[model samples]
Target: MRFFLSVSCFILTFAAAAAAPVIEPPLPMEKAFRMEARRDGPDIALRWQLEDGYYLYREYLSATGDDGKPVEMSTPPGVIKDDPGFGSTEVYYGTATATLVAPTAGMLKVTYQGCQDGGLCYPPTTVDIDPATLAQAMDPAADGPVSPARPQSQAAFPLVSKAAAEPVDGPGIRISDQSANGVVGSLLDRGGVLFLIAGFLGLGVLLAFTPCVFPMYPILAATLSREGESLSAGRGFALSLTYVLSLAAAFSLFGVVAAWWGQSFQVALQSTTATLVVAAIFMALALSSFGLFELQLPSFLRNRVAPARGSGGSLASSAALGFSSALVIGPCVTAPLAGALLYIAQTGDVVLGATALFALGVGKGIPLILMGTFGSGPLPRAGQWMERVRQVFGFLFLATAVWLADGLLPAGTGLLLWSVLAITFAVFIGAFDQMRPEAGGAARLAKSAGLLAGLYGVLLAIGAFSGATDPLKPLAPIAAARSDTTTAKKIIKDSFQSAASAAELSSLLKADANGAPSLVYFTADWCVTCRVIERSVLSDATVANALEGVRLISVDLSKITEANRSLMKELQVIGPPTMLFLDAGNNEVQASRLVGDITTQAVAASAASLKESL
Candidate 1:
């Protein structure tokens, strides 16, 4: 009876679990949405309203007229696509505005969907507006003036007669199009340029605790507390702040240069150089933490420290020192910093870039400043224990460096280099620690010298290897290039392939004469989330079966090639596992585009939506 009861309870629990509703976070609502077209200006501004936990994918817009065909909208001459601000919330949300050159006043249609926290999905909605109506609405003295005191139906969503203008071949604007003009859009409209400014600041604050900046906290705190006088706290605080500001300034400058360089370079940086650089920086930091070498001044350079000796080490001096320290420390947090930089670079807006950098620095600097002001009571005391702490940090840095270097190296070479470095670091640090005396100044100095030698040896080896003929070099380029080519070929072939091949495999579905509504998912093996979707949803029997009616194509972007790279550019695909849907005519359908995480439901819905469009 007891066993029977146990089995019954298990069954009940399973049933309850299956029956439980899936609670998801609220979909980001448009905070603000507005359309601005000045008679004097050459372009129309379609601004968005992005709310927390929601974002609009910028690439797949309604490029066609209501006939469901892709059409090019006039954008301001010389205007570049702006990087949509992916804000800093756990689920970031923000507004984006695009300036399009329009030949005549017509309804601009925007469509979007919302995902609720409870796993409930909102179908795509469109917001449509005639430019003429917007122009009239903007003017208080227009022929048909509506009072602000009137109801929203009268003030905001006014009725318009279709007979006033002949239907043109231009894009059909729908009232339901909410691409940019949603609740969040309104906020952005009200905030104007200031919203972007605030966003940068917010991003900066969040960057402080990232792996890049976190390690510096203890070091900065230790440096500040080393000043043997209580009066030095203010100086230390000032210096820390200054140092942070300098880093911000430097990053801002970088942002300007990067932005000018454009997105292609940014992609290259993210994919290749940036990853390697960040990994190297982390490895170096880890080694330093392990007491591999002390970054200190030489006797000649010691003269510079003399200024820091007396009360002359005022707040200004401290700030200068802090700024100097930042130059070295900034690279450590390059990953997150690079993200912000990339955003700024993509946006090509210097003010916005500067603001973002400033915000990041401020966030990173806060803890250091507070630690300096409050003293090192928050940190572990400087003692034998501190040595252990430093060693741990060194290992961390070493690991980070190895991780980064792996990106630049071929698979075998990267693995070899990482292994060698890891082992070398471990042996050197262990030997030095064993040789050191328990509590003597001379012993400490000797240990420091050993660390220097070890660091020098490691760097020398790296330099030699970097310059020497690498067996991996030839293979690396070929492998990378081949990868790109493979991806491109797959994309092009799958896009143009005979749907008859797919139809031959199944009888329930027929490829329309034009083609069936299909979704092409560009993915990669290296992408973490791509594997997840493939395993969880793409491989599911139900999903696979559902895909029968609609066509599905998967392109592997794991390999690199010029063609693949070009396709990526053409599609404006930023990251892996991007979904693009097309109609039977092989024309693009602006329904739902998802990047990163893929779910069975999303695929199903996308298929359903495309089917309806057909």
Candidate 2:
């Protein structure tokens, strides 16, 4: 009886195991991603409808005509995804469309690839298209469901793997296209991992002189003065180090986010509200420096605050200020920065990228740290000179406030504010006062500087009243009649048509009927580097002559709107001071691209190179 029962149990277990369902293999690549080609107005549209639980890679999508020449295709922004295999990349779910310009009414070839939600990736699929039949292949007016695509034989169209599609040297960016940022990236690729930190540190020190990092000096000085008599070299270094560490952390965090998501975190912080808040903070600090109401924590919190090393109220405030300043102040996209971001984005190696970025911050802070160390030196710590120095910092803080608020003000309002500041400075220095014969050398020097300041203030007032927008070129309009170069500058400046939206940019590009090569300049009013480049490079007569017939379009991104973000994404522009060179057909010549402040010679060279390419 026991043997019979055991045998019955064994048979039942075997039956249950045999009855279990088997997992079915995934569908073929062509069936998973259905493709349909049709003529949609003047453009040939290719749509890929993905199966449930499947998505396509935007980077894999490409089209070419019968002449075997690459065709211009526009695709909507895709969802950013971090795939274990592909790193940080953009993908499309549900439906994806590639709109291509009609290429001489010939046959077209489309290639694409996709992967299942948690399964295998499909091999690259190619679809052949005949332009004549595309019109009848699908109805233009109907919104009905698309019919299943006819599967082409695997033998007729060869499958290309992802590895084969990308260049062997890099994933997406070509090695030959060595823009400034690209050169930095190549350095990263070639340099030993251990040496990368030192290299980035040196690069950061070099970038410290750029407009992006210059604003921090005044801010640091103002913060350090708050310590007054108590500020020794040790305390100063400690405070500066805390601020620098916080800044480095903030930069690393932003760099990682931008690389992983391909979104400008700094741009998000440039909203009107953020700008106003920053301005208000600066104004409050300036007032405090001028002996106004003191800023202090409530008594209850002050007593309870931890006294840990670098954890006092002042140090905490310094850390917070450093982090916030990094977010709101400098949004400049320099070569080393862009290269680090690109490396992270392409390789998804946040650790190495972040290390390099931290080293860069340290390098940039070297000078600031030294300044902080000597912030209170030589002179008696409790003299009237200390108060006077404090007042000077107050003026600097006020100037910074004006600069921050300048972008939001109306035309010439910034110049008005600057004029007021200059006049106030002149008054503070006793510019108009009579001098005695026994005056010291220092007093005479101060008066001389004051006189110059007063004169400039008067000039600024005149220019502001005359409707001049540029502080650097306050009398440009008045001088335009006499100087042919100024007149040429005005014409060249006016030649650039502004595009606030992606649609407007497309319209501008399309309206270039003469098929002239174009230069698309990405700019923002708050971008100090952009202003420098505009004044020094774009306005030059030599550079203007070089780009005489090129279509010039400026995309204003001062508002931080969705349209502006879309334009940035479409053009792959990291930030302002970026200039993209386009061919006669409006196709971007990536090799001739420029980012950050550039020289007139560079612009002329790029323009010449672009025309030669055409």
Candidate 3:
């Protein structure tokens, strides 16, 4: 009986095992694109090991900088795939290699992107190459494991995995014909008018949460602050409707033009002159918030604000501001906008494009509608408290101005301005004044806040002269002096501390490598992201260790000049926080060029690559 029962149990176990679901592991992300780097004479070559079913999007695959500047990268003709958003798209499958002549040396990086046959797509991935090592064959085993569990043959100078590339503003960014194309074309073809409107409206709603849409907030907020007391919900909505319509009209029209021109309107808006003008507008508003001056618009604009009173800036101005803000302040090429633009681009149908953009604008304006209608109900009825709030907005405006000025202004001057602003604010809060014990709670609170601000301001002021660009690291020179962890720490002490003027930097760069490790880091005060890289990794211990004995030179492009500007153009470095590595021969180690923001690990890896070159 026992033997029979055991035999029956074995049979039941077998039945259960056979019945179990065979869950195939989802498509392997790593297997989607296996990348490797190799030498092609003095040039560098990259081979991507693509999975059987996966493919790499060719448009996003680009090579930049010296040795690795991709000269001819050909992708095997891909199966033509029709995408709902991008229309007819060509995507490559299987393994492919791109070869380019190595420039005389600097940072050589290859950035590429891929997608699985099923659906999921990878963002652009980057690989930094060491030009010196490219001459010699790379051992796949020496490539080492990317992590303990995963080994990547192309993972040596991996900074692409540093931080997920700041999410490409919205999903509308599609690769088509080697250019940024959007999904709207396909969506429009499939859905017709009603569906497109609803879709764009949803896209507009999603866009409101993005970084580009934020600047328009203060403009609307300040504009609406006056009418909150007297305007009824109906009047509020009516005015808001006008503003939304105007904004929609302008945004859609602009999108159409931008599409026709084959340029991103958002990029144009970021031009130095444009940003400065916007910053100036914000400054004016900030001053107004302080009651320094009131904006006196034309009678046409003033009459609309207080229709009955006819004394204030008219609602027409608000609408006009909305129109301009819709075009200028919010210039992100989101999925909705992209779709609309793509549709317009392919078919010269202005009506469809305008309607799509207008719908998106209406969606973006929903928050303003709510604010105009219900926002005033919670406010203290036009009292002293409102004045305080206005002041707070003024301070916020100042902060925004500073943020905008970054990358545009000189780093040292910008820091000085910040320190001055903090100190001035502290003084206004009565930090320097002695308060009696009998002081009210509000006064005491103000004093406490003032004192804290004052302390920070003092430190910033000291940092101005101490060769410290970072406010957080005001006393960093002292800490760096005391640090023992990284070679970068010592390099910072020995060489990087000396400030080179715009004139001197050209000659410094031309200086032959002193048979020791060296680098030239291009930076400006305005590049906020670069500051993050500098504080977190450039000064860290592991990187410092790697950079030990490396001569660190800096070229401040904050004050743009013919020499520095030409230098940047020649180097193909568009903006700040770009790191260029040099060997004992003083030639640029192209594979190790770190452009924009980089992670600490990449910096250490870069140092190791540089040391290896030596």
**Predicted model with the maximum lDDT:** 2
- The per-model lDDT (C-alpha) reads 0.46, 0.69, 0.61
lDDT of 1 at 49: 44
Displacement of the residue 12 alpha carbon in candidate 3, Å: 67
**How big is the positional error of residue 325 in model 2, measured in Å on the Cα after superposition?**
2.3
Q: For model 1, how does the per-residue alpha-carbon lDDT over 1-614 read when each residue is reduced to its tens digit?
A: 44336537744753554355423223323222222222213434454445444444444334333455444543212212233342222221344434444446455565544333223233344655455544423334443433333311223222332213433321121212222122223323455334533554565566666554655565454445434343455555554555555555555554445444543223433455556555655555455555566444454544555455542233333444455434333433232344344344332334434554555566667676677666644444457665665665565556545544543554356445644554465455453666534567766665665565465445444533444222223234344545845322111223323212222212212335544666657665444346456646775655665556556665555554554554443344444566666666544555455554567898777666667778
**Model 3, TM vs. native:** 0.49
Q: Rank the candidates by TM-score, best first.
A: 2, 3, 1
Q: Identify the superior model by lDDT, candidate 2 or candidate 3.
A: 2
Residue 299 in candidate 1 has what lDDT?
Answer: 47
Error of 2 at 39 (Å): 23
In candidate 1, stretches whose alpha carbon ends up further than 4 angstroms from where it belongs are 1-190, 204-236, 264-292, 297-306, 309-348, 360-375, 410-614
Q: Which stretch of 10 consecutive residues in model 3 shows the poorest summed lDDT?
A: 170-179
Quote model 2's TM-score: 0.68
Q: Candidate 1's error at 513, in angstroms?
A: 6.6
TM-score of each: 0.43, 0.68, 0.49
What is the clash count of model 3? Answer: 27
